[model samples]
Target chain A: MTAARTEDDLKTLMLLSLDGDEGAYRRLLHAARPLLVAYYGRRMSGAAQADVEDLVQDTLLSLHARRHTYDRTRPFTAWFFSIARYKLIDHHRGRGGRKAAETQLHDKIEDDFSAESLTARLDLDRLLDALPPAQREMIRQVRLEGRSVAETASSRGQSESAVKVSIHRGLKALAARIRGEA
Target chain B: MRKTDDIIESLVGDLKPVARHALSRRFLVAILSSLAVSLVLMLTLAGLRVDMAVALTLPVFWIKAAYNFLIAAIALFALYRIARPDGDTGPVFREIAVVVALMGVAAVFQLALSPEAVYRRLILGHSALHCPFLIFAFALPVLVAAFLWMRAAAPADLRQAGFMAGLAAGAAGAFVYSWFCTENGMPFVLIWYSLGILATGLLGLLLGPRLLRW
Candidate 1:
């Protein structure tokens, strides 16, 4: 999202870095950090936020070591994302055992960004499962489905304030569960 | 959080200039070394076929040699391309299919021209029992050497990369084995030699996820 770091700019930096420009290399890594974090976050919302950061760092380290393998002629995003994906798979394998990781990577990589959305949805479902039915339904309608409070309250034949309270309590419970404090 | 920036700052502080040669250059070095060693081993242990002089005069012998060498070259090219994470396999897969189809056409012509008993003879050639195993044996060292180069290249898809490596080695092994093999029949060359290459490919597939896991 940095103004100075477009994909073309990053590609130029990568090419310069390959040519031994230490400053360009550092800039490239710095610029890539947020992109990598967001890449992991979309897929890791079901897991700890810390694990997402760890994956980003792992990818950066790999990108550093394998910088030479980058082809100057190719688009940098494809190269970078592919490496990010491999690291994500390796991290999962390390955590959940090889079978799970292998299956996850095989299932995910075919449809591109669908994998991240799928994981986020799956994680959200797991998180929502921990809440009571009333609260879960409120959060699902208001927070997930983006339904208006009035629409939700009208559908359920409840007052607007009661629906608002349910949404609030549901979100708080979800956060506590995510924080492992519930 | 600025976690990535902190890591970057630390990495930059410790960064040193690291010179890297082009991957093609490195790949050439590894493959050439492997082929050279395989050739030397083949010559030393198996020696040339007894009919080397007569076989050299024939077109089929040369075609067999050319076929194996061409496959080897294609596999090597695929290996280099796939070693990069961003590389696509579509082109190489198409190229491979075309080559295999051409070889198949050539095999059909060969089968048609030969006499009835020739089919049996070609299938049960004198080296039929040992040909696949010999080529497989020759491919072992090449596989090891290719794997070493691939590890440093950091292939994202190890299964495909390893398969390419195996293929390259297998073709080289078949080429070398051609010099020692007296089975001039195309069927024998196609079947046994292919099986030999497939064996290496299978080995690669098995080792792919395990060895190439980064």
Candidate 2:
């Protein structure tokens, strides 16, 4: 099946599960496991199989607990991936991973060519528009424009620290927007 | 640890239809109930200001209440949004900033219009020393309620979510305290009330990572 068809099917199953359809819920969980494994496996390259499976289970549990947070108006895949990404981040933090590792993980997650990641990326520009102009410009320069913080700071005639703070706040706002959206 | 299949089976086994908008409902219930508790606490502890009748007739009283109420409303919405795994908090933060900024402008205007001698009185009301602590005390119930509800939901950024919850609770507390507070100066509210809210937010920021580990 096409990726679009798969996502639609998953969404239908999720809706049914939300309606208390146990069978659909079971199928949904089953279908999601492989995707979770693949997702974690790709990023956690050298990690043991057991560790990856553990992370998958953790994500599944979180999904179950946070089911009520799922908005019917949102694309299910986006919601699923967000939760998945959150769990992955939590896992890394739990293990006392360095900030660099977390940053790398973020990059890998964004680089993912999965249907959900693509959908989320498509929504990124719209989400950025919701930020204040200053924050939006900072994010565009530092993140989308891929300029160094020093360069962005000099160009904008702002302190480097100010530029960093703006970019941080903007990214945080973008994350919040995404979670609020899908 | 249990196998993944086992976990799935168990999750499905106890499946129940969750009410739609359950998160919002839970947050609303929490805020309302906690506000009620805070109101009762305020009335019993401090009682309404002696000149409540006169104060009610004054525009300043309503202005203070309205300001706190607006902050509470916006912060509560932000709290609710951030409790969700994918919820957005950016817009609410901007909105709250705007509300505070407007109050700041109001305070500046009030300060400008007042006599120079009353400047200290306007900025530092009789309760300035204790106002923030009192507000923080009153905010406890709501903050506790918010934290409890947040624990059940999946928040992406624990510190940010906690701060939002604290801001909402603190604003609610300030709104309740306004009934008993005799301070008529906008600067007092702008300073003391904001300090109270900020302190609570800081507390939340400090506790979020530890309490919201789930």
Candidate 3:
């Protein structure tokens, strides 16, 4: 389920904002509000809605301060999500300065968040499905599971070079698929 | 629920961005100006290598210069990318690794091509012990200048940002040092030059959390 806002719409609004269009900037933030809520909502399920709202506002303020740093050449979401991720990491760190316990909780939260809602939000599975089985499996193992090519190669009984090639080609194809060029 | 309108109101009320186009310009100014300072310092303090006239005529000299310049350029590109909150250093890192690996190969190739006794001489140049320190010394000014400019932006990954700053400064320093350093051996560049860069990178890593706290 994609947000009601399309990537194009977000880009258009951001472009307008960059051009000194304050109205467009407001509208862009307005448009982002619900998506941001949904974003924080999913990760922070069972937690107070206020916490999610606070995080959303925090991210928006951060975006304001950092807007100039945005490169016009790159995708807005990559820039946006990275900011969100940082804020989330900071949020966790601030609340859970309990040290060792904090890392476990953070990892658990990350896995829980990404496994379902995040994957669906990004449409990762559909893109993966479009790839050939070998490439798809390669991407899943290497990219998703964070397995080394050497390890994956040994397990799959393939040469390390072959594994590396597959991972490279797989990611390239995935990017093409995301761009609708596949 | 708190009103989204209120947040929007607060954001738009007096929000002036640092200016979008100005960011790139600022970065360019930082790198160029710092590099200029480093170059001036090197020229004044050490002067060019004694064989400067002879070295300028050699293709190997140009090749080595190209290698150092490319490393700096690549690191600068990486730094520029990560200047933004969302910039990813993963791909840039691979490119850097590939570049360093090629340098290693070039060093080995130079070793193999040269006579057997030349190995020790190439690896341990007259200035082998002092080259890394010199490079590190040159890198300091660039690193400080870079961090000053970089502090204006809000980087999410302070350590990485600092690391990038260090890498960029180190590369720039090495590039400048190439003029003063008479050592042509690839091993000298690979070992001493890299260690110098690494030292700066470590310094950046150490300072990142403190400097880029925001």
- Candidate 2 chain A: 10-residue stretch with minimal lDDT: A1-10
lDDT of 1 by residue, B98-173 (tens): 7677777778888898888788776668888889999988887788889988888878777888888888888889
Cand. 1 TM to true fold = 0.79
Model 2: residues with Cα > 4 Å off, grouped in runs: A1-5, A97-182
Ranking by lDDT: 2, 1, 3
User: Which candidate model has the greater DockQ, 2 or 3?
Assistant: 2
For model 1, the local distance difference test gives 0.79
> Each model's RMSD to truth, in Å?
8.8, 13.5, 12.6
Which 10 successive residues of model 1 chain A have the least lDDT summed? A113-122
Instruction: Please state the error at residue B53 of candidate 1 in Å.
Output: 2.3
Top DockQ prediction, candidate number? 2
- Alpha carbon RMSD to native, model 3: 12.6
Segments of candidate 3 deviating more than 4 angstroms: A1-4, A45-50, A97-182, B1-7, B15-20
Q: In lDDT terms, how accurate is model 2? A: 0.84
Answer with 1 or 2, whichever has the higher lDDT.
Answer: 2
| Candidate number with greatest lDDT | 2
- The TM-score, computed over Cα atoms with residue i paired to residue i, of candidate 3 is 0.73
DockQ of each: 0.34, 0.41, 0.33
